[model samples]
Target: MLLWNPDMNWIRNPFPPAVLALILAGCSVAPVYERPQADVPAAFKEAKGDAAAAGNADWKPAEPADGIARGPWWHVFGDATLDGLEERAMAANQDLQAAAARLAQSRALQQDARAGLFPRVDAGVGPTRQRPSPASQGRPDDGPSQASTLWRAQLSVSYEADLFGRVASSVNAAEADAERSEALFESVRLALQGDVAQAYFLVRELDAVQALYRRTVALREQALKLAQRRFEEGDIAELDVARARAELATARSESLGTARARASAEHALAILLGAAPADFTLAEMPLVRSAPPVPALLPSALLERRPDIAAAERAMAAANARIGMARAAFFPRLDITAGLGTEASQFDNLARWSSRTFLFGPLVGTMLTLPIFDGGRRDAALDLARARYEEDVAAYRQTVLTAFREVEDNLANLRILAQQAAAQDEAVAASLRASQLSQTQYREGSVSYLEVIDADRNVLQQQRAAMQMDGERARSTVALIRALGGGWQAPEPVASASPRR
Candidate 1:
């Protein structure tokens, strides 16, 4: 206690000041938080019954999706190229990196708010000079204003009392905001990975089409050569030879179109990996692998799976906390400031024990401030916070519904596509046989060149349709994986409404 004066009295702090602050803080005015519930089913509808019989043949049975890692999900397709592309996108995509930066900012803000929970201390050492007015110095009006310099070396501490939970509410809001940012970052990452995989699969599907067309071109060339020979030998008419040439030209043109499509898909993939279209090239490889079974999770588990849902829920919580902060504005605010230092006119005397000074009191003696009237500003803020919370609730519910729709949509696609694939396989086989029979008849002069050409076209079309079905199955598989949050793992229990002040 360096404070000493004949007119001043000394007092001892009887209890820990921190404990007193807590006792006086009482309770927060913020409404108790409750996690808004969304309509959820016992199980995914697409995973059972008539809708699932054909589709889920390629799908794994429903399982508890909690605590499972969904990463490396692309491996299920058994495509190394897809896995590689996903890794590249994860590491280099600008959008994902930008989301990570935003998460960092949110965490920093949380730390800033957390600071409000504890006292702030500062130490300063400096010399300050000032000139006093003659009147202020109690001198005659004509007296000279003399300049004086003082040296000070001191430590100060300040803390705001959470009297009505204002500090607590601010901290809560910031924490929720940080949590939301983290979930959003995960959401961005999952979307990027899915996009890369989807694009890769599309490129491979195009490769299959390209290969199919090229084979047809070679066959058509052989047919044209045979027709020319028959025309020279006077076994077939000139019209037959002309038709064969036309078929060959059509095959060549269709092959060129497939090539163009492949190039466009490849370029899109390159951009997803954070490269210019010209700088990236994927090797031509056909999509031959079947899409594997993705775990069909129960609907309740979905609440913990989707990052977007998590983020939306967190937004609601932050808004709820803001309501409390707004309500606290109508209550008294208390700030405690204290300092211990030495001051002297001479720099050399600043360190002397006799020159010591101390103070412990509210800044400017403003011990408390309860809002009286501010043109209804506090009331408006409270209303605004409540409105925002309601808005977040609506958004959160919409997100849940959208998630459900995505899962159901992909599941239906996979089911119907599976059934279609089986039928297309049979059609392709029958067409190939028909085309072979037509070619033999044409060679024997038992059928016109028109019949052979029609049969060949049917075979080509059916084979292409089968290939397209395979691509659709693969695409639907990837889409379902994304809807399930890109992995089987479950998140931590969500923050729920509590009565804690």
Candidate 2:
């Protein structure tokens, strides 16, 4: 038998009236969210200065050709060994793999969170065999204790009515987080590329320096021989010969240190590529080539293009949604529950209509929170979210500023280093001429053997200095490219094709 109270009104919906009530009640407290905005700068500090020097022209539109212009940036050095190392680094880099895994996990969790917006269904079946007690049991025990098997099967379904759109908001928030994770993965990937490239360049530079040191050692040995001959012939003092011997020995000692430094650089590169040092070798350093110009980037476009900045912005969005979710807690939640089942004392009869039973109902739960002073936890949460939003904003701005600084620093370094390199090359040329002239003068007995030795030493130092400057220019260019986010673009939509993977 079923009963309805006289005072209650009948609701014709398949969903119970309580469900509708829950949804209606929630309509009052659902949080309305608006995105917070801080002013975006029109130009980056460094770019402004650069533009001022270049006649303040409008930022050039990025060309598709520009993407293909820089051929792997590192390849400019024309080293096949470096290309192989980079390939290995990308394949086995531990941190990059971790970041990729994290992104995948986030995507899975996003899907899971989104599922809460839909209904849940479950099923169960059980059979029990028991004997009724004769004394304690009811009328069924009148005929003595009886053994029987009871069979039951049921299917249940329940779904939240999303009264305050809490589930929707939460799902959206999770999706944003997943996107943020993906961006973070990209950021990590860029960083890894930069590290590997820089490490490789450093190793190559060490090779160049050590090779130069070996040549210096040889030159010093020659100078020592010349000094000894001159002193034996009574053309120079013993002190001059001793000085030459000491300088030669010092150069040899310095060569030993440079060799060690070079070995360490190679070993570090090996680790970066996940290989044992003994298992790999890099090609000799070729003539160093200057890196391409640092492409100009507009400040307004940088945040959108930079993966880390985008990730930060997405983080702010997720936090904002969380605030909405918390506020939605003050409202009511509507739930619909239904169960269909059959039960029978005999296994054979479990499927019969007479054994069938079903239940369908709607539940409404209003939080009805009594704020009766609980140390302001709810208010604290709101404040925390707001604070986090502000923090993200500040971090975003700081990242932008830092990005500008890096570009500027590298740009200035490249410019200044170029000048220094030009000067060093000139010095090397001058030193070489001086050495030649001193040799001629020595042959003519017009200058001491010490003058030729000094000229040769200066030439070696100048040559090494020039090589070091070349390496600096190359490394700085790489840094600038990385700081600009490797020229990556946001995935664009394609017509008649599936969305991004």
Each candidate structure's TM-score, on Cα atoms with residue i matched to residue i, is 0.90, 0.81
- Model 1, position 352, has a per-residue lDDT of 89
Candidate 2 residue-wise lDDT, 1-501, digit = tens? 112233434423554677457665654233454444546667544553332244212123353221122225455445677677777887887777788788888888899988997899999988988886876676554657768888988788988777777787788789879878877876776677678888888877777888888888887788789889988999878987887888888888877887788788878888888788899677666336555555556655555556777687778778777777766665545566777788888778878877886666633443232244547776787777768767876876777677667766776776677677778889999999998999899868898767877887888788878877877877886787676666433233421111123
Off by over 4 Å in 1: 1-25, 49-69, 362-365, 489-501
Leading candidate by TM-score: 1
In terms of lDDT, the best-performing candidate is 1
Error of 1 at 306 (Å): 1.1
Stretches of candidate 2 exceeding 4 Å from the true structure: 1-79, 128-150, 362-376, 439-453, 488-501
Per-residue lDDT over 1-501 for candidate 1, one digit per residue giving the tens place of the 0 to 100 score: 356455643335523677477547567888889999899987777786343343433243434332233446676676777888888897778887788889888889999999999999999989989998899879998899979998998889998888778889999999999888888877887788888888888899999999999899999999889889989999889999899999999999999999999999999999899999999999989989585766667778787778889889999999999999999999877777888899999989987889898777754656556679899999999999999999999999999999999999888888788778889999999999999999898778899999999999999999998988998888888888889887543233421211011
Q: With candidate 1 superimposed using the best TM-score fit, by how many Å does residue 463's alpha carbon deviate from the native?
A: 1.4
Per model, state how many residue pairs clash. 5, 0
Flag clash pairs in model 1: 33-497, 55-415, 67-490, 68-489, 70-487
